[model samples]
Target: MIRHCVFIRFRPEVGEAEKAMIFTEIAALKERLPGFLAAHVGANVSPETGMDKGYAEGFIVDFADAKARDTYLDDADHRRTGAKIVAAAEGGVQGVLVYDLEIPD
Candidate 1:
């Protein structure tokens, strides 16, 4: 399985409702795209200081494998959603971080 993690720091003016809408849109991708196993989205609630690096929200999407992950990256819907995120995020693309990990047997 491949775990695709995304962290975001929204622009200061972005409201909770807008963020929620973004999350919902992202979650909806599971039904539209193949190879999307599951997803989880939420705000960062960590108590540790200076660790979050201004990223206050994030999500994790699980895929069946790297091929599925690659497919997701290339999907037009996913690209559109990503563009929304970048537009809302502080510093544009700089406000987001993505990390993909492959689970071993």
Candidate 2:
């Protein structure tokens, strides 16, 4: 399995409603694309200080394998949603961080 994690530091002008809508759009990709095993999106509620840096929102997407993840990365919907996220982020594309992990069977 492949776990695709994304963290975002939204711009000051981006409201809570817009943030929620961004996450909702991301979650909806699971239905539009294939090989999505699971997905979770929400705000950072960690008690640990200084851990999250400036990233307040994030999402994790689980895919069956690397191929699935690759497909998702190339999907049109994913690109559109990513553009929205980047636009809302502080430094455009630089305001987002993406990490992919491979889960052993």
lDDT string, candidate 2, 1-105, tens digits: 999999999999899999898888888888867888898999899999889999988999999999989999999888998999999999999999999999998
For candidate 2, what is the TM-score?
A: 0.95
Residue 48, model 1: lDDT of: 95
Tens-digit lDDT string for candidate 1 (42-73):
98889997799999898999999998899899
| C-alpha positional error of residue 90 in candidate 2 after TM-score superposition, expressed in Å | 0.5
Error of 2 at 84 (Å): 0.6
Task: Name every residue pair that clashes in candidate 2.
Answer: none
Each candidate's TM vs. the true structure?
A: 0.95, 0.95
After TM-score superposition, the amount by which residue 55's alpha carbon in candidate 1 deviates from its true location, in angstroms, is 0.5
